[model samples]
Target: MTYSGVVKVGGPADVHELTDLMISKVAVGPMHNNAYLLRCRATDEQLLIDAASEPRTLLNLIGESGVASVVTTHQHADHWGALAEIVDATGARTYAGRLDAEGIPVPTDVLVDDGDTITVGRVELTARHLVGHTPGSIALVYDDPHGHPHVFTGDCLFPGGVGNTHDDPEAFARLIDDVETKLFAQLPDETWVYPGHGNDTSLGAERPQLPEWRRRGW
Candidate 1:
């Protein structure tokens, strides 16, 4: 199969192939949260992002590749609902933002602070601490040497705007500011954004809407 070609399970809408770094995408649960299975082609080692929901399904998808670690993007239950089960089944280490570690149901083996490096086989993912949607919301940055950078943004960012701040002005400001300087300002337009609960987007697409998003305050 080609790198960009998708493998349909039940349907292409449920699962797909990223075609880079052998990343696999799964959209599961009632909320349709996205979970990614990242495989390091160099070593065949794997890492899971979000764990999201559907323990049985996730475990089945993981199969025997063996996950090196499960990175919880944030403390939200929807994101980590099956985290404990996956960890128990695979013995994969757990990682989370230090500030949100206590809130995660499973014990986080590694406290990922901003700029901290998390390894998956030969690949290294840098943690970008983005506070707002939650006090310790984080986005993982994976700069693939073969292509453009890929950022796994939990709920802190999305295609059109920033995550919901519950109408809190301060939280909104903080999230937007950090996103701009830390993510948007630093990464190039080709950077891919793998968000928490929906389809993927690009920094180039989102960059132009920063002003509009700020004005709307969503």
Candidate 2:
């Protein structure tokens, strides 16, 4: 019943309060990226998603937030670079899809794929395989009473455009199809989108721009 790379954060969500989402944006400002911590009040479990940049600083943030489980959307360094440090600092289990396994400095303890869910303290994150930008990329869905589900989109899908697929000749095209089918089709028009490298946005906000994206043709 025990797992590796998984540990406890001292702060409990109820005392910390989960209703507020208790999200602290680490490595923001000059770094200007997001590493979100979702604290569940009922169970006092914290889920850390994506290690933005600056591992030590991120750990400090994690300690402050009380994270329990950490999951990454992709294996790319920018996304996966801090895996070792964060894992070491907090002993939080690292989850990544099988395809992106090679990119992790140390192998991920939990291998997640499409439709699989990782339940931390009080949050349940469903995984969706979305390949294109990195041959192996995925998105995590966080469902709440809020208007729409929250998606952690790595380098795959952004606000206006998806991630660049420079390594793969057909990466851009595949990502377009991924956005249209896997993401947009299944998710509600108003689902919130948390991308790997930009400000927060939502599906409804990006709806109008889909046509423009299609026209640009990757």
Candidate 3:
């Protein structure tokens, strides 16, 4: 039985595989925020990223997978709309960057900092705090043993450019610097970026436009 590639629009989880991991994206709510389900193939242990909206849909997608934790990419309301409900239903521990933990409506079980390691099943994800999109915005990096690395960048990065920085010069500079140095400088070009909203892109695809995004000041 082969797995289909269709990402069910406005409904169930859209499943995809990356080496030993399984990733599912479920688009929810008026904002169409993406809620990702990450599973480790060897142990079947799962972790969800951003329980954005529509608790029922999110819960349905998590069926029988045995979720270990839910990590919110940032404190933005759109990112954790269903967080409380999902946590209550699954009893899974919650994690978020320490700087933004207080802004969230629910209590954070683990306040992660930059360089901290989060063990999911047999693999590990490293936390990189990318400021300016929000004070505590984070990107989770999972390096596959056989293939290119994968990153969940939340709202700090996207296909065309860096995340929205609200037109503030300082904020823009901070975000651009962190993105350029911490992300693009360190990670390989083939690293897959799964953002908080919309479609996915690779660091290789967005690397060249770094100068343009900085110049445009968006």
- Tens-digit lDDT track of model 3 for 1-218: 24342353575566777778888888887787888888888898989999898988888888976588999999999999999999999999999999999999999999999989887799899999999999999999998889989899999998898889888889999999999988999999999888888888889999999989988887
Error at 150, model 2, angstroms = 0.9
Native-to-model Cα distance after best TM-score fit, residue 79 in candidate 3, in Å: 0.6
Predicted candidate 3: what Cα RMSD to the true structure?
A: 1.9
RMSD of each: 2.6, 7.3, 1.9
Candidate order by decreasing lDDT: 3, 1, 2
Model 2, span 82-150: residue lDDT tens: 667787777888888888887877768888878898876656778888878876688888776644577
Best model number under TM-score: 3
Best of the candidates, lDDT: 3
TM-score for candidate 1, please give it. Answer: 0.92
Candidate with better TM-score, 2 vs 3: 3
Candidate 3, after superposition: displacement of residue 204 in Å? 0.6
In candidate 3, residue 87 scores what lDDT? Answer: 92
lDDT of 1: 0.85
lDDT of each: 0.85, 0.70, 0.88
Among residues 3 or more apart in sequence or in different chains, the pairs in candidate 1 whose N, CA or C atoms overlap within 3 Å are none
- Residue 19 accuracy (lDDT) in model 2: 57
Higher-ranked by lDDT: 1 or 2: 1
